[model samples]
Target: MSLRAYLHAIARCPSLEQLWETHTQRMAEYGFDRLIYGFTRYRTSTSLGDPEDFVILTNHSREYTDEFLHGGLYFHAPMVHWALAHDGACSWAVLHDMTRERAMTPEEERVVEFNRRMGVHAGYTVSFKSISNRSKGAIALTAKPGMSQGQVDAVWAEHGSDIQLMNEIAHLKILTLPYSTPSRALTPRQREALEWVGDGKTMQDIAVLMGLTSATVEKHLRLARDALAVETTAQAVLKASFANQMFVMDV
Candidate 1:
């Protein structure tokens, strides 16, 4: 695809599948056979928010992701730490420089080793721009096998600006789409009940407004809480709001 068409397609993607496929294909054409883009707005000092809440789009195999992401190896990854601490694109050459300078921690070394074993040895990482302290997003672009870091660097030297622009736009487009953990999505009744509760309605008042009995409204509220995995209705309301599922104008 031409650069403009690729940019437009990514921005208008209606779902994650289309976005992932298009972006993955575009990156592959640039010799990065693997790509992973992760986004989160719930970062804290001790955590990058819940894993389920992260908008992670990847073309890597389940075997690699399962080991690196679900196996909790992501926390100790050097590049991940670097991304958290800084912004803009960085080459994996930094990792080698750190190794040569003996600046990498033992944990960082282990992550690098694990990645090497998985053929994830070379590429670049771009930590997307964050508008707030609580938000963070990044992408790891992995070079195809047999491609050395030096060669990847050469490719980037010529097309780095275009690569950065594409990723930046993709990241912004993803933020405009809907995202929710599977179990976190509430049913329509559950959502409506929570919306009213969020707007300052009591259970009995909501029952009257919805033409349901008080017990029915209470049931919906309880289900909403369960679906959101929150112990209290107030927490449920806040979480739903964070997920952008509250106060939406119904069509």
Candidate 2:
């Protein structure tokens, strides 16, 4: 597809699943068969916040992600560190230079070795621009196995501008979509109860609006807090709002 057509499609994507599906397919055309996109709104000086609160989308194999993400390898990844510190695209050649100079710490070197074992040899990482100091988003584009950094660079030279534009648009569109962790999605009832609470409704008021007993309404609010991993209903409302999961129109 032409760049213009792709950008239009991305802008019109109503759901995160559709956007991620099209994006992974589009990126694979450029020999980047594996992609991991991560965004966090709760970043702190010492951490990226809880992994459960992050928006993580990827097309990489389960084995790769299980280790890289679930095993805590991402914390020490060289490219991940680069993305945390800067914005815009970066070639993996810098990682190679670091390896040659023996500049990587032991933890970083271990991450590189794991990537090599997994055939994630060459790629690019795009760190998206953020207006808030506590927000960061980035995508790692891993070249197909056996492709060299030189070859990926050549492709970038010809089409990098369009690729970067598409990624940026995808990131922005994703932010507008309602997202909850796989195990933490609120039911329609739970969401409705939270919406009422957010509007400063009392339990009896929400019960009247939802046509449920006050006990049921309170139960829903409690479940919403549990789903969002917040201690209070107010915190649940805030977290849901941050995830775009509150007061969202049906898609």
Candidate 3:
């Protein structure tokens, strides 16, 4: 499909699974065979929030993620630092430049070594515009094995604008979809209750609207609070909204 058509398809992704499949295929056409798109909204002064809360979609091999993501090596990745500091595309060549200049620390050397072992040598990282001061999202595009950094740079030189536009569209579309840690995802009933509450409905009002008793409505709200790890209905509304679980369109 054409780039324009693919952007439309990306915007229409109803779930993360479908979005991952479509995005991986699209990136593959650009000479990148692996992609990792991640977003987080719960960042604080000292923490990047819980790992489960991040919307992560990747096509990297299991062995790689097992060590990189599951093992928390991502926290120490040098490119992650690069992405967090800048707001545009960056060539992985910078990693090598730092290495050659003897600038990478021992911890960083380990990350590079791990990437080499996993065949994650050449790629680009794009840090998207922050949706909020505390929220940031980025994507890592890993070129197919045997494609050197110079070759990947050539592809970017030819199709850079299209790649940036596609990723921006994808970042925006993901915000419209409901996503949460499995522990925080609300039940349909709980979500319905929260949506009404988010719309300024009280427990009695939600009960009247949802065809349930006030006590039942309160029960759902309490469950939602627990699921979201919040203390009150107001907090639940805010947390669920942050997770894109409330006020989501059916599209």
Candidate 4:
């Protein structure tokens, strides 16, 4: 299907299942059979335990899905780790180049073996954090061999932004659904710090901007991270942006 047609189908989706169907249909049009869209909350915990949060939408074989989840493959998936470190969408070629020299852990090797068995030869992964300063996760699209790079790039370049936007919308919708986790509350100072961070300011820069000691700035950031249940200052910034928790003030 054409990109415009695929986007129209996505636009018509009224539920998560419909969104998955649209995405899978689009992927099949491009010659891919397996697709996995996942969200995780790893930044909040020291150990990558069972995702305290999730929003997986997939069209992969049930056997593979069952094996992946049963084996807890996410903890060792190199793609997941790489996606967590970068911003925006990335292709499989980029991932291959990035990890070429790094030795894969045993667990990571197991994930690779699982991928090989499942016929997933190449894929792209995109990540986003909450606007409320709370959580972060990723979405992945996989394809079998024989799919040309041009084909992949063309589709991604045309549809990538919409996919990211949809993921964010879906995330927010899921969060606000009945029985979802309560939203985290932030103090005025914490809110200010989060906004500055999203603006790409460093702690030192924020301290100078706020006319406060670096230590005091750090203290506020620490509190914000704790309240948001994030591990790093970067995660805190992303979560706040995703959750729309940061209040922008005119200087």
Candidate 5:
């Protein structure tokens, strides 16, 4: 598929299966044999127990994935760790060359060996975060050794923004998915108050705009905070924005 077509497909996928199918098709077009797309909630309460908060999809062999997870190899994978530390585009070979001077620990070497055995000679990984930046994750694309850095760079240059947007969409999907521990939903008035706050209106200003007493505005704001399970209004606004429930007004 053409780059534009690949991006359009990614943008159009509303479900995890569709997202993976689009990703797999694009990977084949780009000549990659193995592609693993995953979304992890690094700091969520359930993250420690359930490593895969939401996996968008993957075309890699299920055996390999199961082994990788059971072995807990990802936690010690140097490439995964490095991806989380950096921003922008990154390739495995580039990172290897850059860090070659420093010796890998025994555990890191084992992780590298595991990946090598999986036929992942070279790859690219991009990291992203949710509304709360503290909860972050990374997506990786692994390929055989002969692939050139130039090819990877070109793909990234063309589709980097779309990748970022997909990551955001994935994050929002996870947030809205039903959890075992049910969470409160925002009331219409609370949502309205938070939307105004997200638009950068102060309590007094929002009261005037909504034609409500300041006391009533404050009550709505408090309700919004409770509904979002945030400690304060600022956190509530940020959460709403991350969930695509509100947008900041230019004014």
Candidate 6:
């Protein structure tokens, strides 16, 4: 597909799943068979916030992500560090250079070794620009197995600009879609209660609007807080709003 057509499709994606499906397929055409995109708004000076709060989408097999992500290997990943510090495309050759120079820390070396075992040797990492100091987003495009970094670099030299642009567009569209980890997800009733609270409604008022007793209204708000892992209803509203999960049209 043409670049223009791909961008248009992503811009109109009604849900995250559809957008991700379209993006992964398009990227595979460029020889990047595995893609992992991650975004976090809860970044701190020392950390990228909690893993549960991140927006992570990947086409990699569970065998890879299960350890890289769930096992916290991403924290020690060299490209992840580079992505956090830079705002553009970088070749994995940089990591190779670092290895040659013995500049990688022990933890980082372990991550590199792990990737090598996973057949994740060749790829490019694109670190997306962030407007907020506490937010970061990036995508890693891994080439098909047995493809050397030199071969991947050759493809990048020819079409790097178009590839980066498509990824940036896909990342922007992803941010507009509502996303919540399963544990953070709210039920329809919980969301409606929070929406009312956002509008400054009292418990009784929300109860009347939701056709429930004040006790049930309070119950929904309490459950919302638990789901969002917030201490109060106001915090839940803010968290949900940040994730674009509040007052959103059903998709």
Candidate number achieving the greatest TM-score relative to the actual structure:
6
Candidate that beats the other on TM-score, 1 or 4, i.e. the better one: 1
| Model 1 TM | 0.90
Residue 164, model 1: Cα distance from true site in angstroms: 1.0
Judged by TM-score relative to the true structure, which candidate is superior, 1 or 3? Answer: 3
The better candidate by lDDT, 2 or 5, is: 2
Point out where model 3 deviates above 4 Å.
249-251
lDDT of 2 by residue, 1-251 (tens): 77887888889988999999999999999999999999999899999998999999998899999999999999999999999999999999999999999999999999999999999989999999999989999999999988999999999999998899899999999999998887779999998999898899988899999999999988988988888888998898989999988889875
Better of 1 and 2 by TM-score: 2
* lDDT for each residue of candidate 4 in 125-239, tens digit (9 for 90 to 100): 7766645233466667776567754677777777667656655554455443211124456777888887888888988999999999889999999998887688999988766
Instruction: List, residue by residue over 97-210, the lDDT tens digit for candidate 1.
Output: 998999988988998998999999899999987889988999999999999999999999999999989989888887766568787888888888988988899888899999
Worst 10 residues of 4 by lDDT: 174-183
RMSD of each: 2.2, 1.2, 1.8, 11.1, 8.4, 1.0
Model 4, position 12, has a per-residue lDDT of 55
Candidate 4 all-Cα RMSD: 11.1
lDDT per model, in order? 0.87, 0.93, 0.87, 0.66, 0.63, 0.95
Candidate whose lDDT is highest: 6
Question: Which ranges in model 2 have alpha carbons more than 4 Å from their true place?
Answer: none
Candidate 4 residue-wise lDDT at 130: 49
* Model 5 per-residue lDDT at 222: 89
Ranked by lDDT, top first: 6, 2, 1, 3, 4, 5
Q: Which ten residues in a row have the lowest lDDT in candidate 2?
A: 242-251
Cα lDDT, model 4, residue 50 = 35
- Model 6: residue 40 alpha-carbon error in angstroms: 0.7
For model 2, name the residue pairs that clash. Answer: none
In order of appearance, the predictions have TM-scores of 0.90, 0.96, 0.92, 0.57, 0.57, 0.97
Candidate 6 residue pairs that clash? none
